[model samples]
Target: MILAAGQPDAPLLELFLAATAGNVLGAVVNFVLGRFLLRFEHNRWFPVSPANRQRAEALFNRYGRLVLLFSWLPVIGDPLTLAAGLLRTPLPVFLLYVTIGKAARYAVLLWAYTTLAG
Candidate 1:
């Protein structure tokens, strides 16, 4: 919505900051949920399937903390954060990486809007 709007009502800096903050907060919630819900694996209502969980775990293992850099992606993003929590990733580390990813994503979107819309 923000990207497609072309010209947002709010200032670009405000938009960027708000989007980054909201996305990071959401990821944090997902992480906490993952931490507490570790024992609820395989339930029908689980957001991530067993296959997705395995894949996320594999990626996290292979890339270490760096994989959180892609946590802004759509389908796999939530699982990545959840996996980080399930794996007991440090809060400071998760916040740092996820904030960078989401801020970069919004910055790119804003740049594209300016470049292409002008």
Candidate 2:
């Protein structure tokens, strides 16, 4: 979608807005899921083990919400957003960082595409 949006005739601003909005929205979903999932922490069917959860929480505490800046990374991005929610990161803080990261990612990609294609 992003690559296609970078085509020469594409409406850059509109495409950028759409891409960023969708990406940030997806992250929000992950954040919400993380928050919701925590309610099942003690349930037998909970996926994450308690020890693993504790270790993740410790790491999140060490790094803090700044990790949300990397929320555009592929494999780790989704998990990072999710972790933010699991750790009870403030929604406003999460949105600010996540939006910046996601928007920057698309902007960079578009810039690179336009530069190379030209």
User: CA lDDT, every prediction?
Assistant: 0.86, 0.90
lDDT of 2 by residue, 1-118 (tens): 4445636678888888999999999999999999999999999999899999999999988987788999999899999998888878899999999999999998998798788888
Q: Write the residue-wise lDDT of candidate 1 on 1-118 in tens digits.
A: 4442545464778778988999999999999988887767778987778887787678788889988999999998998898889878999999999999999999999899878876
TM-score for each prediction? 0.77, 0.88
Total backbone clashes of model 1?
0
Error of 1 at 99 (Å): 0.5
Considering every candidate listed, which one attains the maximal TM-score? Answer: 2
| lDDT for position 26 in model 2 | 98
Tell me the deviation in Å of residue 39 in model 2. Answer: 1.2
RMSD of each predicted structure: 4.4, 2.5
Measured on C-alpha atoms, candidate 1 has an lDDT of 0.86
User: Candidate 2 versus the native: TM-score?
Assistant: 0.88
